[model samples]
Target: MDFSSKLYSIESELTQEDLDSLKFLCLDLLPNKKLLSIKSNLDLFKELEKHSLLEEDKYDLLAELLYIIGQHSLLRILGTNKWAMQETLKKNRTVSLYRQMLFQLYEDLTSEDLKSILFLLNIPKKYEENKKFLDILYYLEKNEQLSEDKLDVLEKAVSMVSQELLRKINDYKKTRVKENTSTQSLYDDKMKLSIEVVEQVSSQDRGMKSTVELVQHVSEAANGKDLMDKNTESCMSDLSLNEQSETEVYAMNRKHRGYCLIINNSEFMKSDPRLGTEKDADFLTNVFTWLGLDVQIRNELSTQQICDCLIDFKQRDQTERDCFVCCILTHGKSQAVYGTDNAFVHINKITSYFSTKNCPTLAGKPKLFFIQACQGKTHQGAHAIESDAVSSVEERKTKITIPDDADILVGMSTVDGYYSFRDIRKGSWYIQALCENLTKMVPKGEDILSILTKVNKDVSEMEYSKDRKTSMKQMPQPAYTLRLKLVFPIPLAPFKPLFQETN
Candidate 1:
C-alpha cells in the first residue's frame, strides 16, 4: 500500500473546504498578485461573497479569508515579490495553503484569530485533528512573530473550545439515541463497537498525556520556569513553594563532572569484525561529549571488563558527578549481548549496578544505554531470487542481560528476530538516525524519550534489502523506566531572535 498517498488523501479530506476557502481568500487578500495571475481577483471575490452569504457555517470561510490577507502582507515583508510568487506557481505549489498559509497570515493575523486557534488547542484535543494548524502557529511563535497576549488568548480559546466540543458531542449522541429508536439494534451494535474502540483510544491517550505531563514538569523545573526560593525539604512540604526547588536537589550540577563508557564487542568466535558495533560506540561517544559529558571509548572489551567499568562509575561521588551513559555495540542472541571473549552476559548485570540501593549517587538521576545488537538467532534475510549474493552466516549468541531496577533507558537497534544493517565502511542505520535525531531534538528542548521516539520513526521508515530486488524492514525500539527527564543544553540559545511586541 502507498501509505503516503493514503495520508495525503486523508489530509485532503480534512482540509478540502479549508483549502477552497483559502483560495478564495487569497484572491481578495492578494488582489495585486492575483491580477498578475490568470484568475481575476474581482470575479473570485464576488463569487466568494455570494457563497459566504448563502452558507450557514461561514465563520471558517471568513477566517480563512482574513488569514490569507495577513499572509500576503507577511510574504511581502519576507521579500516574496512577484518573481518569487511566479516561481512558486511554476513549481505547481499552492503558496498560501496549509502550513504556508500561516506565514502569509503572520503580518495581518489579529489577536482574536490567534485566540480562536489557541482556544481550540487548550481544550482536550487530539493532535491529529489539529496538528497542521498547530504546526503553523508553532512555526510563527518560534520565529518570534507571535505575541504573548495572542498566545494567552489562544490558550484560553483552546480550553473553551475543548469544553464546548465535549458538551456538544455528548448532547448529539444522546439526541441521536433518543430520536432514532426504530433502528435501535443497528445503532446498539454500532454504538457498542464505537464505545469499545473509543475506550481503547482513551486508554492510549491517557498514557500519552501522562508521559507528556511528566516530561513537561521536568522541562519546566530544569529551565527555571518555576523556580523556588527554598531548598528541597521546605519546597516539598510547602504548597506555596515552587516545585523547581525540589527538583534542584536532583538536578545535575552544570559544573559537576560525568563520564561516558563506550564498549564495542563486535567480533564473534571465528567471525569477521562488524563495523556496525564500532559505529554505535563512536556515535554515542559523540552525542555524550556534545552534551558536555566526559567520555571514554573502549573497543573489544570482554564481559568482565564491561561489568567492572559500570561498577566503578556507580561508586563515584554524587556531589561531583552528573549522569552515566553506556553504549554496547555487539552481535547478540536473545536478551543478551556478546563480549570479545565469546562470553554470554545478561544485560541485567550491567544495568543493576546503578540501581537506587546499589548506586545512591545515580538513584534519581538518568542512566542511558544504547544497545546495537541482535536480540535473537532468527534470520530475516531476503529470498534467494531477490536476495543479494551475500550468503547468510550462522547466528551468534548474545551474552548480556538487563536488570529490572536499573533506572536505565535501553534503546535497542531493532526488534527481535530481525537483522540490523551495517555498512562495512560507515556505520549502522540506527546510529545515523540516532545521531541526526539527537542533534535536532536536543536543541529543541526535547527530552531523551522524545528524541528516541523520533529515532524509532526514522528507523521504521528506512528499508533494507538483501538482494537489490527484495525489501526487508528493521525498526529500532527504545525501552525505558526513566525516573527523570534528561535535558541537554542548547548551544545556540543565546543567539535566538527575541520577540519584541505583544498582541
Candidate 2:
C-alpha cells in the first residue's frame, strides 16, 4: 500500500477515538528519541496497535499512545501527523484530546486555535519548530478566532517537531531569497548592511589583543621614567599619608575588601530602538544585589551621568572598601558605549576616573569593570574543542600588585567583531552567567576572581548550532597591582538575625 493508503487502512480498522490516540502517540514520540535510537518509530507503531484493541477506550487512548512515544522522535514525523491532528482538533473542539495536545506543543503553536490544534495533535517530540509560529498563533488566539481549547491542541502538534528539523527549517529560511516587495526587501537589506557595518567597526578579535599590547607598551614606557617623576612630584605636593595609613588598616581588618558597581545600560536614547537595555540592567542588578554589594541599577544615562555616578560611588566610604566593580550594559562600538542621548562615549573616558592618581578613594583598591556590549561584528562558525584536562599554566596570568595600590579587571561580552547575545527578554548572556556564577560562588566561599574565571569558561564553551542560534559569548581580562587580597562583605540574611538577651 502507498503511504496514504497504509495510513487510511490503519484508520479504517480503528474507530475515530483509536485513530486520534495513535496520532497523539506518534506526536509524543518525536522529541524524546535519542540521537541514534531507532526504537521511537517501533514503539509508536506498537502503541497505536495496542490502543486500536479497545473501542470505548479509543478517545483517551490516543493521548496515551502519543505519550508513550518520546517528544524527539514524534517531532521528526510532524509533517504527516501535524496536518491530520490539526483537522481532527478543528472538528472536535471540545475534546480533552485536543487540550492534551495543546499543552504538549506550547513551544511551536502559532495562532491560538492552531496552537490548540497542534497541542491537541500532540506528537511527542523533544524539540519544537520555530518559536515564531507559537508567538504568531498566540497573537491569533488573543484575537478570539481560536478558542482556548483549540489553541491548546495546536500547541501540542507543533511542539512535536524535532530540534534537527527546527534547525533545518531556520537555516533554509535564512538562505531563501526575499520575494517580498522590493521596497520592503530594500529596507531589510539596508538594515542588515548597517548592522554589518557596525559589527566591522567594532571587531574585537584583533583590536582587543592590540589594545592589551598598547596598554602594556604604554605602561612600560610610563613606568620606565614617567611614573617615578610623577610619584616624586605627587609626594612633594601632598605630604599627608593619612589616607595610605587608613587603607592599610582597613586591608588588615578585612581579608578581602572591594566594591563592585553594576550598571545596566540596556535601553538607548531613542525611545523605540531595536534593542532594549533595561533587561540587561535588571539582570546585572539582581546579580550584584545577590552578591551582597551596594548595587546601583540605572537606566539610560548620559555619559556625564555615568561619570558622576562613578565619582560619587568612589568618594563614599572609600577608605574601607578594598575593591571596586563597575559593569556597563549598553549598545556599544569597539571601544565606545552609547549615552541615553545617543552620543558615543569612549569606554576609556569612563574608566579613567578610577585611575590610581585620579580617584584617591579607589586609589589602592582593585577596580574591576564588567562590560556586556558588542565589541565588533564578525560571523565565525562554531567549532568544537576536545574536553581534555589541560594544565592550569594555559590560564591567563593575572596581574598582581599591592593592596594599597592599583589594579583593574575588564571583561567584554564578545571578542572584537562579534555580536553579543542580547535576548529582548533575558538580557545579555554574559551578565546572566556572570551574575549566576557570582551568586552561586560567593555562598560557597569562592573569591570574586575565581568566580569570573568560571564566567569566562561558561561563556566560551556554550554552543549555539544553527538549530539553537540564540547562543553567544564573552571574554574577560583581569589586570591588577594589588599587594593584598580584596574581598567583599556578605551580609547575613535577615532570617538569621542575632537576638540579644535581656539584661
Location of the lowest summed lDDT over 10 successive residues in candidate 1: 239-248
lDDT of all predictions:
0.53, 0.47
Candidate 2: list runs displaced more than 4 Å: 1-260, 269-277, 314-317, 378-405, 465-484, 489-491, 494-503
Quote model 1's TM-score. Answer: 0.48
Error of 1 at 116 (Å): 32
Clashes of each: 29, 101
Root-mean-square deviation of candidate 1: 21.6
Per-residue alpha-carbon lDDT of candidate 1 for residues 1-503, written as tens digits (9 for 90 to 100): 24333223323323343444344334324443442242433344344455452133332333234323322222222234322333333223322232332333433344555556655545335533443443445544555554422334333443454453333333333433433442454445545555665555565656666657655544444433212222222222221111121121236664654777777766555444564455456666666677777888877777787777777777887545777777777766566666766665676666788777888876667788887776655443432211101122545444444555645787888776556766544467777688777766565445677688878867787776766887767788777776666666554322221222122
The TM-score of candidate 2 is: 0.40
